[model samples]
Target: MNPDMSAGSHNGISMVAEGGYQVAILPADGKQLTLYPSLQIDRAYYWTFEAKADNPGDKIYTSLWGDRGAKTIPLTSEWQQYSSMGTPNPNYQYFYFWSVAAKGNVYLRNIKLYDAQDLDIVVEKEWR
Candidate 1:
């Protein structure tokens, strides 16, 4: 978002993503997102995102990235918050979010990314 834009609103708009395991600066349902990048893999840093569905019938999901084991965290239309505590993966370039799972109106906010101390690249022995 530009300096002129305000939080919780869609203005000065950029790219919008639909769903599932892909990366986007903004989540699908259009909520302002902010980030604090840390390449410090020494320990784990975590934050929470609260999703209040536009419709109570809608079941939503939330997900944050780590070194490994990435998936969507499920939530409902009611006010719900998800917390993550794990050693951030410096190996991964960018974190991703999606909504192909629950399938409903999803609102995402307060996303925090804590990276590892440093990235270690692994080389495979067998070539496919």
Candidate 2:
């Protein structure tokens, strides 16, 4: 994934997802984009991001994994802010944002994660 430094994004960089993936699986090595201060058990956390697709129908979504598995949230094609809040499983570990399919492109920026009390947590944008 190449970050588009010229996108003039809210953050220092914008993710440029060239192609889509059916599933953003966790790597065997275990390193993934983890939310700092590991979400507390039975507490709600808010997740947000800015995204835009290259084509009108192109899209993206995120899958959040916890003890059981995860849930998905769809994103729009145009540049806009998106968010979700929920009490994740006690074993919540990592989350992944993936394109719809093995086609199209999408750009994402200004990703943020916060707890129920509206406190911003450190989210390291690491890729696997």
Candidate 3:
């Protein structure tokens, strides 16, 4: 299916998806989503989002791919916050949100990406 955009809380953009599975690829290019590129090695970075599933167990997760390798965080169905950090590939750069095995629908909004050094500043742009 085609990607869609809709209103979310605080008039922020929200990503809606239905069917089997969907993902917002990263480097979050301006056209797709809004996230920074080229993470520093061994640095602590945070990625957060607000999400709810149409049904229970519609796995939501984040993927980090770098020269070091890859990492994933299993997310919940309820609207909540989650965070994780890992070594980044010096050669590769990017992260992504995945709705795996999603059978019904899902809503995601308020995405934030930042480093531990500064929680006060979000590095991502408004998703489009």
Error of 1 at 19 (Å): 25
Q: Residue 24, candidate 3: how far off, in angstroms?
A: 7.4
TM-score for predicted model 2 compared with the true structure: 0.53
lDDT of each: 0.39, 0.46, 0.46
Tens digit of per-residue lDDT, candidate 3, span 67-97: 2222233335566555444455565556555
Model 2, poorest ten-residue lDDT window? 21-30
Q: How much is the lDDT of residue 96 in candidate 2?
A: 45
| Residue pair clashes in candidate 3 | 66-89, 67-89, 68-89
Give the true-structure RMSD of model 3: 10.8
Show where candidate 1 strays beyond 4 Å. 1-36, 54-71, 112-128
Per-residue error for 69 in candidate 3, Å, reads: 10
Better of 1 and 3 by lDDT: 3
lDDT of 2: 0.46
lDDT of 2 at 34: 34
Tens digit per residue, CA lDDT, model 2, 1-128: 12222322122222344444111222222223333335566656666666665555554545455422233334355667765555666565445455555144555565566665655553434222
Tens digits of lDDT, candidate 1, 23-65? 2233345443323343354564443444555455344322334
